[model samples]
Target chain A: MKTKRIRAGAAAMTGVLLLGACGEGGPGGSGGDFTDGKLVLAVMNDQSGVYKDASGPNSVKAVKMAVADYKKKHGDKAVVDDIEVTSTDHQNKPDIANTKAQELYERGGADVILDVPTSSAALAVANQAKTHKKLFLDVSAATMELTGAQCNKYTFQWAYNTYMLANGTGTTVTGNGDKNWHIIYPDYQFGQDMTKSFTEAISKAGGTVQGTIPTPFPNDNFATFLTKAGSTNPDVIGTMQAGGDLINVVKQFNESGLKERGIDLAVGLMLITDIHSLGVDQFAGTMFTDAWYWNMDDESRAWADRFRDETGTRPTFEHAGNYSAALQYLEAVQEAGTDDADKVVAKLEGKKVNDVFLRNGEIRAKDHSVVHDAYLARVKKPSDVKEDWDYEEIVTTIPAAKAFPPAEASACSM
Target chain B: MNAVLQYAVQGLAAGSFYALAALGLAIIFGVLGVVNFAHGAFYMLGAVTAAVLLDTLDLTLWWSLLVVPVLMFAFGVVVERLLVQWLLRLDPLYNFLLTFGLTLVLVELVKQKYGVSGLPYKPPKLLSGRVDLAGVVLPRYQLFVFLFSVAICVLVWLVMTRTRVGMIVRASTEKPDLARALGINVGRWVTPVFGFGVALAGLAGVLAAPFRAITADMGNNFAIILFAVVVIGGLGSIVGAVVAGFMVGLVEAFGQAYAPTYAQILIFVLMALIILVRPAGLFGRKEATA
Candidate 1:
């Protein structure tokens, strides 16, 4: 009888502890139950599709590393001890991303979701994050809609956007006297945004878009499209495609005598790994906007070496962005002493953070657009490439303000 | 006139690959009475094998062209013996479904081994440049692909028509009971015939490696088009499959060149029209009941 009574008492205590943990939005709270301080970060991106190499499982590794780095730096003074990181592959689909985003926030209790690549999928998550009042840090997807029309308080886009690419590459190329542009874009939100932004950027810089071709996503045969574009023979052929499609487009474009006809090839947005995969010879003399290059400096190289050991590949800008975003979120939670959405958002807005990955990183308060220094890199010729990954030569550094459009231009009501 | 000629030539080149792949599909369907959904995956395997051979083994494109098909043939034989032969006596749907599962398994296996990123592959130096006919220039690789595909088709035709082994295999597939009653061991030829058909798909993949983005799911992209080609040409008609392959290719190319946005519907529309006009396909034999 005495032992039974003791067990009953223990059971009651366990019940009370469960209540404390469930105090997140429950009635029994002192304003709010900040008792259970657990940080769960979920990486949401393409893990087994075209965008996988750029972000995917590597992004998960990057997040874990950032968490480790955060703990090492703060030690006992760290934000939270109970931290967990998880991931889901969206497969570049908007519906799947929405479902995963909901599960991550509602059931899994993720504090932040990182690295959604496809714009349509990212937008879906962005809307879900806003509705759920959760944090989403998009490290890769390029649609400016994230910070423009669809932007929300809980979502922050960390890397380059379509506007940044348009301003960086489109305007630069136009200013260099490539007056006529033929833009071939994948028929998706991201690609369409790239086309729109690039067209506006070029026209504003005194260039005319001769034509815009909306090609199928994941299109392998760009031969006919190339021939048609070749017939027109515009001064510049702007490829607004990404991943495997981009590789094919660039290859066919080069082989179609457009270059011999003196038409320049301008990639609206390109990852470093793409140039590496295609080799310096194929994309030589091509120009594009780059978010981050792994071999940019000693700091970058050191981080990249660690990343290489982890992933067996050099970290692309998207992968690096995941690390930086995770670290920033942790820092914000530490500064605010809470992982509450409002508190974290307040802590992140307009704060200048510096790390190996981002310099002068400012998460814009209005549209939650993280702005940092961007660069324009031109593909190095085969003779100039000293190493395998030595594909791009940094042409010019773009200031944060100049790279991104003004915040007022954003249609986001946030 | 220049645009028309350009689109035509380019379309024909793209069609050649579809033709090669569809020919393999037709042969398998004809002999096995099974729709091999793994056809595209086999094509992808061919391309990836070439990539791995070049990147890891330091082998060249020529070596891949020479060796990969033979390796693929061996793989097909094993797959046929272990998996496909078991499903032969069952419903045809069983093999169809089995091939579909096998395709998924193969695709996932490739994804696990080599992540879903595109790999780089350079063409042979001999086929690297453009050929100028008048003022317009076309890629030399495309021209080579066209010529090589035509040559392969002719060789396949000659084998089926002239050679003893090919004649026996063709006769066995077409009139299995008759050939079996004539004291021929028709069962022995089944495995080799399947392997030969799979090998043809592998060959097309090797040819496509230099042009398409060398990736695991690259096959899925081409597979849908190849299926349309097989359907339009008739399910098991060799002539129909080859002709339909080129026809679909030309249709897609012209569609993209002219319509651009609506090209997705062009091939399907053509398929619908073809089905309406010729129920057994342009080359498919009419049913005795009909």
Candidate 2:
């Protein structure tokens, strides 16, 4: 799969110059717009790494579905005749992402990039988008910087961020009497952001921080950190590691008899796929914040059913977010009557959206964050699971206003 | 003090996999003189195979520990005969590149079959809980892994020291040209020795199947750390691999416990120090360095 993605990239690189020449000669080759005939939506993320399951090829599939559904809905009124989706594996490396993002914009002829997952890698691609003046809808990465200091006119943080996750889980968990907290986070931009956000949320909810431990990114083992966290005798241990790292921590915590020792785990961020991988029993009764859940309502269930038919697995929040972002981007293109980044950005800014994934979603004009209602969900017991992948039960809803940081707080001047 | 004991036990348990895999790397480097970059892939394959066996045939972890290594041994033998044996006479870099390529191919193939989400492997219920001894609490499986890997290391060490076959293999490993000149048929042991080394890696993989994430790229980082383990253990030293394995594990544990940020960096620091003090590794024979 990795080799295939590389081969595809190589092929695209070879065709770049020729494609660029042809694009300039097209009908709408004016200075104000750039749309040859088709719109290319490129999905770049950790295609073959730990985060793959959450938003890899499945995200690509969701993008394609968005195009198809758009075509079906608009029919003759569709702005673009065709929408093409392409994807590549950044392998969760920022340097690789920078190169691939450049390639996607220069030679790959991508109009918009979708679902760049890792916070650092996503930020790298955001820089490329800003440079190339292309749209980048970040559906998966959880860093607030994309909407803060690093925010760009060309990039949109679509699904969720560390602020939303920490606000939902940290406050609720601390408020439940687990006041003393020890945090273990992957030592990266996303992890650091999650730690800071969770600490803020915990303190706001009348709690004191015990300590915070930084573990290696993409690390397989967490025994040492778990031991260190336990040494402090905290009421709750908050883990900011996600995907495979989160699974390992939860598994190791279960094995270390920490739950029996009465030390509760507060997950900073979690995905349905992660819960499915470790089984519902391991994470049963655990509370975490979710951007979207497949079984939330009838409309969501219907979309998820179609998604299951396509991918043979239930969709994570990221998959739904990708679909929503892609569809919204296309709608914005239709509203603006062009694939030009500036026009699309104008159309999307401050737009209120209600879709299967984004409930009460608003594309804020200030920071480019698509703020939406986040759900505080608890993992159901194994017996409570009525069907496969039925993992979460929504406990409460954190409104859009409370879910994300206010627009004035953003460091982005634009 | 109890925390110290806990960290030490935890470190040793974590070291069990490294020790087992490094022993295989040492053996293969010792005899075949081929740096098996595919060793980690083989370790990944072992875990994948064990998970698959459990899923399809309902084989338990007990069965996997016994069955997976044997399968890996045969796989190693075939790999030697079909691929590695031909590159024996070339520059070791050629073989290293070959194994490196093999690692990619194997990893991609596994990823194709099992999506990157990783497979689930639950340890036996008996080994699922914790064991408390004198106020120190440790996972039951970690304790089992530490003890089991030590037993296998001792058994392999005994065979190398006592058995005629092992003696011949060791002679060839210690001095291949000299062994040939001394009327020992060193070439005949090449295939099995490689197979045995691979089996040790496979055995380690089986031990780790329940303890770690069983994914395709699981071995990518592992292989890197393993190289550090090998370098610190002395490239081709048998005892060094096992000793350095546990030693690195203990160091990693203590470092992680005390300095969580610099835990992984500490392994390389220790390796660099060992290399500076003794170019041929801690227990490596001086002649082997040449």
Docking class of 1: medium
TM-scores of the models, in the order given: 0.94, 0.94
- In candidate 1, clashing pairs total 0
Summarize candidate 2's per-residue lDDT along B206-274 as a digit string, tens digits: 888776778887888888888888888888778899989988898889988999988888999999999
Q: Itemize residue pairs with steric clashes in candidate 1.
A: none
**lDDT score of model 2?**
0.88
Candidate 1 residue B213 C-alpha distance from true site, Å: 0.5
- Over the stretch A16-133, how does candidate 2's per-residue lDDT look in tens digits? 5456522222333323344545688999987777788888999999999999999999999887875779989999889999999987777676899999888889999999988888
Worst ten-residue run, lDDT, model 1 chain B? B281-290
Query: Where's the lowest-lDDT run of ten residues in candidate 2 chain A?
Result: A21-30
